[model samples]
Target: MSQATKTIQEINERIRKGTAVILTAEEMVDVVRAKGKSAAAREVDVVTTGTFSPMCSSGMLFNFGQEPPLIKASKVWLGNVPCHAGLAAVDAYLGCTEPSEDDPLNKVHPGRFLYGGGHVIEDLLRGKAVRLKCQAYGTDCYPRRELDKSVTLADLKSAELLNPRNCYQSYNVAVNTGSRVIYTYMGPLKPGMRNANYATAGQLSPLFNDPFLRTIGMGTKIWLGGGTGWVIGAGTQHNPKPQRNERGIPLTASGTLMLKGDMKGMSAKWVRGVSILGYGCSLSVGVGIPIPILDEEMAWFTGVSDADITMPVRDYGHDYPNGVNNVLAQPTFEELKSGEIAVNGQKVRTVPLTSYALSLEIAQELKAKIEKGEFLLTEAQDRIPSK
Candidate 1:
C-alpha cells in the first residue's frame, strides 16, 4: 500500500458536503475483503465502533445545592447508598459498586446482592424520586446539622457521569474448572467448565479497531450513553503492552479509556443499572467511537473481524482469585460467539455479558450522525502513553 492519508479536516469537509463515506466496523470488513485495504482506505472516510456492557468503574459526580444556613456536609447518602463527600460542602461522588448501607449482602444466600449505587443513578436518570440524607457539622457560618430530602436529576446543580476506567480492549473468557459452583463478576459459572462467559464487543469494540491507540486518546469525541462525551485520559490499569498474536491484536486485556459526560443528556436505556447474582451492582454503559481513515494502516486495522481476534480463557473460580497467571486456552472471538468453545477437550457453552445487537445499533446511529454532519471526528489533543 502506498503512503496515502486523509486528514480530519478533509473528512469534515466531505461530511459537510454530504459526501462522506461512513461505515460501521462490521461493514468495513466486507469492504476490505472485496476491494483491497488500500482501496478501502481511500474510499471510506470513517468507521464507527460500539460496545454496551457492565462497566463497574463508572460513577457519578454531583453538586447538590447548598442548604439553608450553609452547613459543611461530612457524609452523604442517596437511596441508602453511600457517597463520598470528601470534596466541597455539597460535592459528592457516588461509585457504582457501592452497596446499600442496609443491604443484606450474602446473608440470605450466597451471592444475593440486591441494591447498590448503580440503581440510584438509574433511578435519577429515569426521573424517579430518590431519598437523599446528609450529615454536617455546625460551622461558624453554617447552623444546620442534619438534613433529609427527596431529589431527582433536575434538582441537582450539576451531574456528570465520570468513569475512571472503561472500554477494555480485550478481556479474558471466564470459566470454572473447579468441583463446585462459583459466582464471579463475569456471571455464575457452572462447575467442570460447563459454562464460559466473556465481555467485549469483539471486532465492534473501539480499542480492537485501534489496537495501537493511534487515533483514540485524550479529547477524542465519543458517544456515551446516547450523548456526546470525550475521552479524558488513559484509564487506570491500562496495560498498553500485552501479549498479541501475529495479527497485532491483543490476546488479553490491554487499553482502557477514561470517559466523562453530562448525565442530563444521557438516556436511561443506554445507562442502565445491572445486578449480578453474587457480585455487587454495576452500571451498563453504551459507548461508541468513530475512527477516521487516516491511512492504509488504519483501514487494515478497522477491517479486523471476529474471526481474526482472539481472547484468553482463564479459570475464574481458582486462578483468577489466586492471582495465578495461567491461561487455559486461547480461542478466537468467532468461536466464542458461536455459543460454544472447546476447553481441555470438553465442550463449554459460551455467553456474553454485553449485548452485541445493541452495540451494533449504536454503531449504526453514530454512522448516521456523522453522515448528517451532526458528528465530526476530532484529532487527539494528546495521545495516550503506551507504557
Candidate 2:
C-alpha cells in the first residue's frame, strides 16, 4: 500500500480504539481535494483548525505557503489519529491529549470548546439532547445584587426574569429619570417600547419576538421582559429599530403559569429577567486563513507560480471571477523563489524568515500531537447516554 494509504489506515485503526488524533493541513487538504470541493464542503460542517495559529503580518499572504490542513471528516474517529470511520461515529473524537511539559504545541492553550463541523455532524447522526443555561444580572452588569437590594430566585420568576421575551430585548442605553434608574438590555431597544415612553406591560411587545428570550425558557418556566422606562428629556429623540427578533422567537416561555397575587417587588421596569436563548450563540464575523494546504499532486501539475494564490482570484480581475486561468496563474513556490511573484507588493523572498520558522513549528506540533494522541474522540455514551 502507498505510504499515504498506510497512514490513513493507521489513523483509522486508532479512531476505532477510541484515541485522540490530529490531522495535518496537508492530509486534510489532500482528502478534501480528492473528494472534490463540493463533496468535501458538504461533508465537513465546521472548519476550526486554523484558529490556533498566528495571524499573518503580510495581510495578503497566506500564512504558511503550504502546510497540513485541519478538517473534521464526515466520519467518526479519534482526533489524534487519521482513519476511516463512518461520519456518524465522529463525536468520539476529542482534542489533543493533555499537553506535556516538553510539548511545544501545548504552548498554545485551547479556548472554549467549539463543537461544529464533524462535531455537529456527529451530533446529528447520534440524535443528542442539548440543554442551555440561563442566569440573571443587574443593569450595571453585576450578576448578583447587594444584600439590601439582593434579588431572589422567586423575584426572578415573579418579575419574569425567566421570561424569554423580556430576556432578549436589547438594552443599548440605560434609562435614567433623575433617581429613577432603569436597567438596559443587551441589544437595541424595541420600537413600541421606545415610542410609548411609559413603562407598561403592554409596551413590552418587542420582547415577545426575541429568540434569546425563548431559548432561555425552553423546557422551563421562565419569562423575560425589558424596555426603556420613562425618561424626562428636554428634546431628546427616541428612534427604535423595527422590532424583529433575529432568532425568530422570544426569549421567554409562552405557556401559562400560576403566580401569587401578593408577589412584592415585581416592578415591571426594575425587575430584570433572563432566560435561555438557545443551544448556541450565533455570531457574524470575518475569519482569516493562517495556513494554506496545497495538494502536492495538483500543485505539481499546476506548476510553480506563487503570486499570492491565497488571495481570492475574483479580487484580482473582474473577468476571472471564477476563471480557470486565474486559478491556474496563482503564485507558486517556483514563481515566488524566481522573483516572479510578489505578495502585498513585496517580493516573496523579502518575506521574513521568522514567519516560515513559526509555520514549521506549528506544522511539527500538530503532527507530533496527532502521533502522541492529542485530539481524540469523545464517547457518545458520555455526551448523550442511551437509556
Candidate 3:
C-alpha cells in the first residue's frame, strides 16, 4: 500500500503551484485504474464528491420576532402546516414532512397533505406571505390568547437551515417484490422490483470517497445549498463500525452528516423542498465535499468504483412500511446501474432516486470555486471515530 500521510503545507504548496490536481470522484476511478493509485495520489490534491437526494430527516428552524401583546405561543402554523413552537414566542422548527392539521387529505387521502412543510419552506424562500396563527393561554402581564398574522422569511429574527441529517454515507437499494405498488420515501416502489431506486451518487459520494474519518470531520468546508457550508459532525445513526471491504469502505449506511447553512443565502434550485404526490414532503439537498489527497493509500480509497461496492436489496413489499423482514437479492451498484438485476430468479429493472445530474453539477461548481481560490480546504476541528 502507498504511504498514508501528507502534510497540509505540502498539499497547499502543490495546490498553489497548480501542480496539485483535483478530480471529481467519477474521474478518479479511471485515474487510479490507468496510472495506478500511487501515481494518481502523487498528482492529485483533492477529489470532489457530491450527492443530491431527497432526505426525509431534514428541516429548518426559524425564530420569528416576538409577536405583539407578548404571546407565549402555545401553537403555530406555516402555510397551514403545524410546526414545533414549544420554544420562545414566534419560534418554530419546521419538520419537512409536517402536514396541516386541517389537511384536506384527512378527508380524502386520509394520511396525506397537498401542501406540507416542504412547500411552506419554499414559499417562504420565494418571499411569499404565509398565514401564521398562534394560540396562547391568557396570562397576566402578557394577556394574549390568540394571534393571526402574515409572515415572510425576512420577518424572522433568525432563520437557520438546520438539517439534523443531510447526507447518508452510503445508500444501497430499495426494492418492491410484491404484486402491488408501495409508497415509500424513495417514491413509489413498483412491485416485483419493476424498478430499483438507488439514491447515492455512487463514485461521487463524499463519505464513500473517504470512508475513514481522515479529512472529513467537524468544520470541513463543503458546498451546501449552493453556498459554502461546514460539516457539524457525524449525523444521527452514524455507524462507523459497519462492514467494509479491504479498502475500508462501508458496504452499508455507515456514516452521515449533520449540517447547517444560512437559509437566506440558499438557492431553491439546490436546496429544494419537494412534495411527492401520494407521499409526504422531503428536502432535495445538494451536498459536495472535497477530500484531500493526503497520500496514495487515501487516493486509492477515494478512487473506489461502483463495481467494487455491493449492498443487499431487501424486500420492500408489504412488510417494508412496518419492517424489513427479508432480503431479496444482493447486487453491486454496477449491476443495478446496468438497468437490470436478478432477484428471486427473476430479472428486475432498476432505477435511481437521487439526481446524478444535479450531483455532477454540484461537483463541478465546487471544483471551479476551489480552482479559483474562492474556496479553501478545511481541516477537521473534530474527528469522527471509526469504532
Candidate 4:
C-alpha cells in the first residue's frame, strides 16, 4: 500500500477504537465558555483521563465547559475500547502518522507522561550538541662516586638510575702537596626507575676508606608517564579538613584534580627516597587542565535544573487524548491540498489546546472584520460558521 493509504488506515482504526477526539472550532469555543480560564488550565488531567479509557468512541470531549452533546451514528457502535484504539484515535485526530515498524521512533519506550512530553518539546526547540581529555607522571635518577667525592666512571656504567646512592659518589683526594685534602660530591643522574644504596656515618668510612668520606642525603627523582588511568593519592582521597575559599565556599581535597595546560600531555617527575632496603615513592607534583563541555545555559537546563515546563511535547509520543478534533478546535485549519492542518511555529504541525479561548478570540475578530466588509469571502459555503 502507498504510505498515505497506510497512514489513513491506521487513523481509521484508532477512531473505531473510541479514543478521544479533537474538537472542531465551534466546539473549542463552547468548551472555553463553559470552563473558565483557570479551570481550563487544569484540563491536562482530563486529557489524561481519556487516555486511560476502555471505550472506543471519537469526538471532542470537554472537561471544564458544558460537555459536548453526544453524537450517535447508526452504523458506528460505541463502548468497550482497547488502550491501543484510544491511542489510535488520538493519532487520527492530531493527523500524525505512527512511525513505521522498523523506524527508531517506534522503538522508543514511554516514560512519565508530563516530564517526558515536556523534555521532547524542549529538545525540539533547542539544538542538541556533547565534549572529552586524558593525562600521566614521569621520573628520573642517576649515580655518583664515594672516593674523592667525584662520580666514578665504573659506577656510572653500572649505577641504577632510580637509586640515589648508586648514581652519586663521595670521596676525599689530596690537593697540592699540603696536608689539606679536597672533598667533592658529584653525579648528574638521568631519569629512570632503579635501586640505590644509602650509607650511614660509620658505613661510609668502610666504602670510601677515607674517614672524610661520610654519609649524605639519599634521594632521587624519576620521570613517570602513562598509566591505566588517572590516580589520586591518599592526601586527596582522605582530606584532613575541608578548606573554605575567600567566598566562604567550602572546598574538599578529596576530589579529582585536573591537570593544566600542556601538562595534560607532558610527563611528570616522581621523587623517591631510600630508606633501609626498600624505597618510598611519592607522586610528582603537576598541574592539569579541565575539559570544557556544554555552555552554562544548556548545561543548567539539561543537568542541574528542575524546571519541567521547558521540556518538549513531541518526545512524549505525541499521544493526544482528544485527537485531531482537539487540534482543529483551536487554531488549526485543514489545508485543501494536503487534507492536513498546518501547525504553527513548527514546520506545518498540530497541537492540542485544553480549550478554544484563543481560537474563539480569532473567530470573533474575523466575524467583526467580515461584518465591516473588510474583505470578501470567496466561497459562501466556507463563510458559514463551523459547528
Q: What is the C-alpha lDDT of each candidate?
A: 0.91, 0.22, 0.79, 0.17
Worst 10 residues of 3 by lDDT: 318-327
lDDT of 2 by residue, 185-288 (tens): 11122221221011101111212212112111212211111111110111112112323323222111221211111113222222211110111111110111
Candidate 3 residue lDDT tens string, 1-387: 455667666766766766667788888999999999888878888888888888877777888776557777788887778889888766789988887677776558865556678777777777888998878886775578887889888887877777777778776578886798877777778876787777788778788788887888999888987877788998888887887878786767778888887788777787777766667777788899998988887888888998977766777675566775455667887887788888878887888878887898888888877787677787899998765
Kindly list the per-residue Cα lDDT of model 4 for residues 107-185, writing each as its tens digit. 3532101111112111211222100000112112211111111221121112111110110111111011113221111
Q: Rank the candidates by TM-score, best first.
A: 1, 3, 2, 4
- Residue 170 of model 1 has an lDDT of 93
Off by over 4 Å in 1: 1-4, 104-107
lDDT, candidate 1, 109-142, per-residue tens? 6456688888899999999989889998878876
RMSD from true fold, candidate 3:
2.3
The total of clashing pairs for model 4 equals: 61
Q: List the residue pairs that clash in candidate 3.
A: none
Model 3 residue-pair collision total: 0
Give stretches of model 2 more than 4 Å off.
1-12, 15-329, 337-354, 377-387
Order the candidates by lDDT, highest first: 1, 3, 2, 4
Of the candidates numbered 1 and 2, which has the greater TM-score value? 1
Task: Report how far off residue 291 is in candidate 4 (Å).
Answer: 65
